[model samples]
Target: MNIAEFKKNLLQDKISSAQEWFFIISVSLLCMIVFISSDVFLPFLPEMTKYFNTSMSLSQMSLTAFIVGLSLGQIPHGLLSDRFGRKSILNLMIPMFLLATLGCIFSKNIEFFIICRFFQAISASACIVIGRSLFSDVFEPLKAQRAFAVLVPLVSLSPALAPSIGGALSIYFSWRSSFVFVFIFGLIISLFVFIFLPETKPIEKRTKNLSLLSILNNFYIMLTDLKLLYYIFIVCFSTAVWWVYAAGAPLMFHKMDYSAAIIGLLYLPAVIPYFTTSLIARSLLKTKSVNYILNIGINGMMISCLLLFLLESFNALNVWTLMISVTLVTGSNGFLLSTAMSAGILHFSKNSGLVSGLLGTLQLLAGAFSAALIGLFANVFDKHYYVNLTILFIVCGSILSYVLKRKVIKHEAIKSF
Candidate 1:
């Protein structure tokens, strides 16, 4: 090959086409449904207790079941997709999602409803793992980072909007209406994906052996790679911090005597920073290295956490301070999530399916654990728990940042030598 051909091959995603952009958007939209499934239930929690004739705690098991199913389903879906091909697996799962949505809508009892949500989350898991793997199949590291920078912010918006949509549906119609809304969404997405999205994983590249043991062994091997481990840690800590904030922020607002509606509006400011920082990240990737941007983001998060701690300790915590601190945390997340995912998946390109599955599984598991841990302490610590949780988040993030700097980043430099 000539020099030009070699350079072209070296830089993956050199050829940008309309079809590629459309495929990325379609996958992003598919992945967004996973968040929607979780968040839409948030507003329905109070009604759910009454609807199910159960205690609040028991009713909340629905969420936990969904989380478990979502986390556990990714590995199998990803493994199957790698063996069977992306299009067939995606087509199979989207319809299952639609069926699960319908089941949730009409269920007469809480147990059945929870079961349906579990299946719904399992089906949604396909979107996340396969969508990410598909990105790796088509784009190189830098281009994949750019694509995620755009995609992550859009997907993140589902949580911000879900409560509003859920609340409206519950007020105007019924709690059941929330599931109906999701069902209609599933129908539209299934049709769109079936008709338009092409199979990206071609026959030549499909894994010949489809065995559970092989998938698990590859998963374990990937976990042992130091660079991949750090990348996963970056995503885990970033997701944990967000879940901590999501769990504790409401209690802090309530202590300030803010009404539910007013408190809901506060999420808007926190969410705006995600979009702004994503735009900033996209622009910086044009000239800066991914490690540099990731370092800046992690440092920004640590500082934000420290500021939040001080503000709460001084009894100076208010909406503006809260907004600023939350913005820093969420904005940094926007950068970290996309960059970590791109860099991490690149490290395991040969096993993109396994890597994507492990990434999604650990990400959800970490977020769930974080949220649960914060919730356990919320009553005892009262409003101060938010400040303390932020500190914990920072402590965890700082360790990951050290690993990224000391190991992953330095290893790359040594490679150049």
Candidate 2:
């Protein structure tokens, strides 16, 4: 088919061929693999400390370095892709990721390992920001939301699943095996992308000038949109809540005498609800408005946060209770983030790459900051402080939700008029 016809079918949701679906699924896999990267080696973190003979604090910097690099890398990659084209950026990044993974596998010390992970994260981040932009390139706004609804829940499964794989690999082979597995996975994916993935950003549509000022101007314009900013903050805060949970949960489970394998299993209850909610999100789009879905998601998060507060206050620290509370949080996160992302990116259709990069950067930075804060307070604060942070985030998110609702209503009214 010709280019116009192909785009028409995509916008119309006529993904008829197996290859088309594979393309979509492959890109989604690109998005999902990063999260797997995020957590696939988490189960081996303590082992890594011992293996490298590093302090606990230094060992944990592996995660921090990756987050920081991922956060920092998005904007530049997005801007460059917008200027230079997407396919080339993808080709460059995937190979970088392959190399970085190998570096991690062979690093002699924690410092080198952390540096390798940072580069690995930088390379993997291109897939995420570019993947979001790719949806806008191929699908119309509504179709893109539906696609996100379906893909995100599946993507959300990575955190829980990766750790299980990591725990198993660490148990059987070694910590290095986890990196090897990822390297092999990255190699295969990269080969597929290089061979099959076509450039979505057409030459005529690309920015003519590759200037820092032009990039900054694009960001300035998008950041000034109050409605867009609100959705961005919603994504940011929601991500922060999840980050805190990830940071604190391992310690909490350890205190409760759970091994990494068992902890991985415990995450399933929470993840199952999250996946179910994502499927629900896809269906909800047919009958419900975006604002309605977003509002409901916010309420869900608030309710989940309150339950966590109550449980922590009462010292109800059992597995079942903790599972239920976290399930609510994860489910609500799945609900809110997917919708917020769709709405936020729709506002910047003229520059999807830039906005996707900004949205991703903000969310990752929020999570990074939360992780840093948790690390800082690890010694000073009690374990229950994690729950307190969750409550605080919900309070902040609730206020942002209120503002977002008001702004969205006003924007809609203005558009209607």
Give me the candidate number with maximum lDDT. Answer: 2
- Candidate 2 segments whose C-alpha is farther than 4 A from its true place: 1-14, 17-21, 46-56, 108-112, 309-317, 379-384
Per residue, candidate 1 scores C-alpha lDDT tens digits across 1-417 of 243442243234554465456656777888888888777867888887897898888788888888888988998887888888887998999989989989988888889988998999999999888888877777766777787787777787888888898988877787888888888877777865676555767788888777768766786788767788888888888888888777777877887888999989888888888778876897888899877888878888988978888897799877788788888888888778878887787777766787888888898888888878877876764456777777877887787579666986677788888
Q: Candidate 1 — which residues are off by over 4 angstroms?
A: 1-21, 409-417
Query: All models: lDDT?
Result: 0.80, 0.80
What is the Å distance of residue 270 in model 1 from its true position?
Answer: 1.3
Q: How many clashes show up per model?
A: 0, 0
Per-residue CA lDDT of model 2 for 162-244, tens digit only, reads: 87788778768889988888988787788667765667788887888777787778878887787898889888887888878
lDDT of 2: 0.80
- The TM-scores, one per candidate, come to 0.90, 0.89
